[model samples]
Target: MAARAGIASSSTTLSPRVAQGGSNIRGEQRGKKRKSPCLSMPLFRSPLSRMLVSPRIQLPGIRLRSPLVGHRKSPYAERRMLHIDLNMEVEEENADAEERGLDSGIDQVHQENAQNCFDADDDVPVALEDEETGVDPGQENIQPWFDPFFDSDVDDVVPVPQENTRKNVVPDNDKRRAIFDAMLVKARKGYLKGHESKEVSAQFSVPVRTVQRIWKKGKSCLDQGIPVDVESGRSRCGRKKMVVDVSRLEDSSILSRTTIQDVATQLGVSTSKVYRMKKEGAIKRVSSSFDPHLTDQNKIDRLRWCLEMLDPRSVPHNPVFKPLFDYIFIDEKWFNITRKTVRYYVAPTAARCIRTIQNKNFIPKIMILTALARPRFDSDGNCTFDGKIGCFPFVTHTAAKRSSVNRPAGTIEMKPIESITKEVIRNVMIEKVLPAVRAKWPREDAGKPIYIQQDNARPHIAPDDRMFCEAAKQDGFNIKLVCQPANSPDLNVLDLGFFNSIQSIQYKSASTTTEELVAAVDRAFEDYPVRRSNKIFLSLHACMREIIEVLGGNSYDLPHIKKGVLERQGLLPLQLRCNAKSVNAAILSLRTMADT
Candidate 1:
């Protein structure tokens, strides 16, 4: 069968050979019978038989599949194959790949070589090679491939050209260099070193280290007689010293022992100026010398007693006695009451008799009523006075005595010179005195009995006056009569300050009659200044303090009349009990005098 098949394959070629188809083969000539068209083809035949008998097989009419697949070769293919071979050899030589024993394929090798070649030529423009025709590397005038498009003569499609204008470029490098140079110059002049290098760094826009390096390198030259740049010299005003004035300090020394603080305060200067003055020996200090003993008990007591004599109810007892001693020490000139001058005029001897118009000095008599703890101001007492013709105790002897004949006939002679009588005393005590006393000491002495101080005179301790006293005791008031010292006026601060003031004013405007005198006195009393009242009160307070001190800081049991007299003088005692008739009469006298 094999021989047959080979002969059949040979015969198919012989037919083509006879007709110039020698290249072609015939199936029948080779002893391979041609099958009828009606016969079914055999399945799974031998390889040679199939090749010989396959009618579909064409001869010499076949074409190459692709250029790369064909047996015919080109320079490009040969070169590519050579490169692939070279890459295979290289991959085989690689120790790492060889150790793994990986046998790479020719196609894979070719692919890798192609990838590496592309990578190598990535930056070179593809058009550059096309343009290079045959240019040598040294040829500079070889136009690039796209030059034809740019040429004016060629019908080239050129894009419109844009104008090239210069743009703003920052001079960063030059500025940095200038800053460095400035710092270097500063360092060379010795104006920057250590701390100064840091300052220069801040000022010149350079690093501290750079400034420091320049400083150290230039410092030796700077020290060795190289003068500093004038630009880097210390500011003239910076090193100038401050000067202080010493003349101001000398002026302060004129003040006596004044401290710098005091001088500063006085002159409206700063304390620092004063301190500077002290340092310059311009001022000295002085100590104070004030006596502390001037405010002793005796003086304080006297002052207090004087104050209390104004208002006995409120005054302390210790000071009440102090007024006595203080009064004794007072200058006699303070006690003497000067009589008012009388301008006497002789009337024409026609009205009744050869008459002198009696130009009398009017002094209103203050009827003081007082009570004491005992009947010591009675006739039996040591402090007695001739009430008829002499001044009574606690009464001022400023009025003159008159003869009986001179007294107005038929008129109630209730004059100041009248002698004391029981009826007269009773009338005065009940009508004038008691009421005035009550007005001052409004609250009757309920617990401890109060005394009425007076001189030993008929009017003071008379029978009627005694009876009146008894009647006062019955009416919830413990009344007593006291005997005052003879001729003692100093004990009364009120009399010295207040009453004296009233009398002085009244006497200056003398009156011719008793009515006129009363009116003048009343007007004068009313016109007493508020300041005088205040002074009188103050004096009484002083006297009370004195009395308190004398009594060892205890209470005073002094006569009520003494207290009343003080109150009246000070204008303090507002409560007084007097007969309405007497008060009315006094008021009438004042009114009448005022009218005249």
Candidate 2:
């Protein structure tokens, strides 16, 4: 009581003479505080603590004892007692938790707490917790009761902050369409409502002028009875096309065009600017590669090879390439156990995967010999023969002679035949390729001859190699090996498109060992659809047609017939029909060369 009296008396400057109902002790305390010049606030001066501690005894410092403040001197005087109504908001962040039977509090989730310290005068929230432990000092957001009237300055109106949007940006098609649709909603027969353009410009992040232009374009289209299309010609309105004198770059060496920087340097511009040229097709990216140099005899031989594949029955008119159902294409390709660059889609929180290999230059790779024949389709397009003879890996199983970290001694392991030789190819053909052919060959054509077409690679054995002849004779199968023309990979079905298709599927799975690599390739080979195999056969026939046209040159682009759409419509041809004149000319040219 004494501390409260001293605190209330020290505030004499805040009291008025109309409330001079004070005792003599109050006068003495007020005089003492003035003379001492060391008046400190009472320990219980906090209104909240005082309210809690002295609930029955009203404190004048907190609430006026009289109806009006300064009308009394004693802290407890109640003559015409005025109650100072405090504008406070009590917020409990525990309603949701309480309903769910969970406790919630300011800094913990296990307990509930209610805080009542939102001050209307200062527009600040006060936390009751003593000592700050990195708590966020609450914001002074004005409460709803006082926000509109609580103007710190009477004359000035506060401006609400908005996001910064760049001016004069041409709106995209979707935004323009939206703006036009909004205008159309309120449009009175094509003219936008008076303030519609401005309103729309504010709604979307677009300029009023741009919005008006879109509205005008839409109205113009609407007047013509066309669908309202306000699509801006943004693609055409951009920076003018870059004029590249391709002739000027003609003399540039390969080194100069190897990189964008080199080309940009020669053209005297930043490398960044060259990408625009690339995008605009003013500059193009081309790969520097080596293709086999063709000789006149090689060309003649390729021409003859195409002439031989033609069906003699259709030689006179509407010549169709022979159905290559009995022809099996065989090729050996080296598949990497895992590529140097493999892509994986992982979650943001997933651990980064680190792939390690023994040696980068010597990444595990194995040679696979794959055999494929034309898939035979019944009248209903149901496949009778899937045409996959087999994919055989040139690997041998041997016991490890020495113990290593990866394996113990005498453990059987699969090791790829690294140095593939003619003998290895010959052995694989007799043991694996020939047997698969005999087993998978259509029963209807059991007595018919089968031919395996191989590239003229060094490792390829002769057509009548002794071991293959012995094995092929045993199955009552007259399977002969024919070599494609030298330097003519387009002549074979596998090289034309089959290998590329299956390899793309093969690369989808990761492989770490030679066995896994072989398994992946075999899986890819079987997973390859027979319908696509038929398309590849047609692609080979298309290549042959191109070869005959260019006099055996492989310079023509692969023709696309939209085979999928055609196949869906049941119009896919069993064999591509060739022009009679083109075939005759090819034959005549070969004869003329033979005479020379």
Candidate 3:
């Protein structure tokens, strides 16, 4: 019986016949199972009680008894299966809620999320979360800043143009750096309204988290009343280098190595490092043209020769050197028809020159006998006579034995004499050199003592030769022949630098035949500037002084004087002044010579 506000229930005893049928069914199941009072009430079951008797769903961690085997064939089984499936779905939802740490309000929150419409400025939910703890799955402790609205009145604040910012971003010290910093500050501070990091990031094309950090630092600086500045990077954060000691370059251990790479290997450094040392002037490059190997006696002879040039009268006082105005310098050189190697500049599309020589070493050449004297200049610095006596080639004219394309048979052609014997040198001195010197000899120096300075070559005749003596006696000129120190070309004015100058000018023209070569050399000799010969005479004196300085060793650079300028000012002296210390040094060296 049920008595409630909304329901009235009356129970009547069932008839004997219906009760007997139910009792017989119950007694029949009681024989196969334990009798329960709940099973006995099936005859008086109410609607709620009938529902409780239907199949119940089994949840995880809940135990349930099996229904009677008779219900397995009942018509309610299909409906009971559906109820079980529904119960399973509800349990799974509860389990998921527990895993996500959500409270019981999770379902209401989910429903609200699904039903609510997002406005243009509404914050978007990024992920689903727990019901009990209200935390997103797998995000327990992270509290990332979320500002979707970015509330600010400066929503219309225009960002600095990217092109303007990029254009002015140079290295730190550049003037454009001022503009870059200004633009960067303006763009970053635009987000200061509510510290909207995402807006600043989007405006500047930077990461969201990066903007957050930058904004944080800028805010701190603003609070301290300091201007916000973005640092480029940590200073001096580059690779470290192992510096090598360069002072060791002068050490004997290092100097023994001849090559730069060799030195670098010994010092444990790169060749570029050594090259830097050279470029910085820690080392030097020099092409050493060694002196002719001289014995001790040769050194003594050289020393003696240098001493003879010093003026004895001026010694022990302000020493002055002899002008040697009447000294004639003579030497022989073989001028080649053409250089072995030559460089030329041509148009890009032009053909290169193809020159062939039978033998580079045996190129057509002729021996030229050159003679020069000290150029004489008047008080007004006008050259009274240039020292160019004459440049004569040791050549001859002979009939061609056979006909060729260049010339007919028996044609008299000028040809170079390959073997210049002593007779040839004597003839050149007696016939060519003597005649030219006599004709070109200054009228004032007609009778003065003229010395012919020649190097010690085997082909050169002795100074006391009868032919030279006879030749010297003519014209009332007391011309004497003198030989410079053996193996000492530096003492000869012709060999000092004049021959090289002549060759340099001669090579400028391409000569194919020996006669052309001879002509070219002769022209070069004449083309030599008279002023350059005067310079060479002064340079001869300079060399004499250097010989004294080095104790007869020719290990010195040619001293240079602006002779043209001096000549222009009327200050060019025929004889360059010698250093007194050098004269004394030469005398001392000669004195210390061994008797042997």
Name the candidate that leads on lDDT.
2
Candidate 2 RMSD to the real structure: 16.1
| Superposed Cα deviation of residue 237, candidate 1 (Å) | 49
Candidate 2 residue spans exceeding 4 A from truth: 1-242, 265-277, 280-283, 345-352, 403-407
In the range 1-596, model 2's lDDT, one tens digit per residue, is: 43332223212222221222322324442333222211222233233532333212112222224322233243522122222223321122133324433222212311111123354578576443312111122422211111211122423534343346365687789888998898888887656665877898889967888888888888889789988878877678768966656566678888777888788877877787788888978888877556678988898999999888889888868788998988999998888876787777999999988988778899878888889888888998889999999999989999999999989999999998879898888888888888888788877787888888999999899987887777787757787889989998888888778888888898988787777888899999999988988888888888888889887876777788888999999899889888788888888888898788
| Whole-model Cα lDDT of every candidate shown, in order | 0.38, 0.70, 0.65
| lDDT for residue 202 in candidate 3, whole number 0-100 | 57
Worst lDDT run of 10 residues, candidate 2, spans 105-114
- Collision count for each candidate, in order: 66, 8, 9
Our model 3 lands, by Cα RMSD against the true structure, at 24.7
The TM-score obtained by model 1 is 0.25
lDDT order of candidates, top first: 2, 3, 1
User: Worst lDDT window (10 residues) for model 3?
Assistant: 1-10
lDDT for 403 (candidate 3): 100
**What residue runs in model 3 are displaced by over 4 Å at the alpha carbon?**
1-267, 560-573, 594-596
For each candidate in turn, the TM-score is: 0.25, 0.58, 0.57
